[model samples]
Target: MGALPDGVYHIKLDDQQFLTIGEEGAVTVLPAQDVGQKFEVRRASGDNYAISKPSSIWPSPFVCYDGAPAAPYEGTRVRLRVSDFPPCEWKITAGSRPGTFTIVVAGDGQPLTIGIAPIPIFPPFLQLTSSSGKDLGWTFEEAK
Candidate 1:
């Protein structure tokens, strides 16, 4: 797998759940939809990309790890942030499965994986976890 072409996309996990923007900008996984679920992926440098919600209100924010790089570990959630700091970028790379990719934090190199929500009622969310698991694969479908 190579770097994804710059464009808008619907990021899916294992072809089942789509990466969605939940209330207050939390990133969660759920069934696919046509609106408010798309991400604008722009190549910042090399394999690094800035993933953001184009449909968001003014001063659009991009997804990034929620903790400091020095302390990153499993369960570090990804959230939409309104900053241009280094942590706001991600290293999108080839994943364990074909036709999929793993999104890694640019600052600490931790791969984003599927994680259970703290509250059972909420859907699964994306979090920084060990790359040793089978949950790091994600598919990028160009949004039409």
Candidate 2:
């Protein structure tokens, strides 16, 4: 798919694991539950989409180290900042697997890639790695 249509969705890495955004703007992959795993995908002026919490309506905007609107570099930790509200322009491009998509970091003009095999914990999520990897962790399904 080119870009995910504007709507609310539960980001999924598989049938079980889901990407959950915390109140303090921390992102994590959870096993179950529909509490904080939902994000509002809203189309911006162009191909970018704003991801946010449904209840709080806080936008998940990606910011750089200096808190700029540019794409993040490799190994840079990302977080949702309300100050930027709209965040970086994310390009939803086709991923390495079917039914999955790579969230292109418009800030850095590159796709959002996961780190090494061990996987990352909470707090500050790991940064993007090789662009050719199959990171289904970024794949999300439209919530009902």
lDDT scores of the candidates, listed in order = 0.74, 0.59
User: Candidate 2 overall Cα lDDT vs. reference?
Assistant: 0.59
Clashes of each: 0, 3
Q: Show where candidate 2 strays beyond 4 Å.
A: 55-66, 107-126
Residue-level lDDT of model 1, residues 52-141, one tens digit each, is 887446566778767644556678778787654434667788888778787877654445544444556667666777666655488899
For model 1, the run of ten residues with the poorest summed lDDT: 108-117
lDDT of 2 by residue, 33-60 (tens): 8587777778866776666666553433
Candidate 2 has a TM-score of 0.74
- Model 1: residues >4 Å from true position, as ranges? 55-58, 68-71, 84-87, 108-121
Output the worst ten-in-a-row residue range by lDDT, candidate 2. 57-66
Kindly provide the TM-score of model 1 when superposed on the true structure, using C-alpha atoms.
0.82
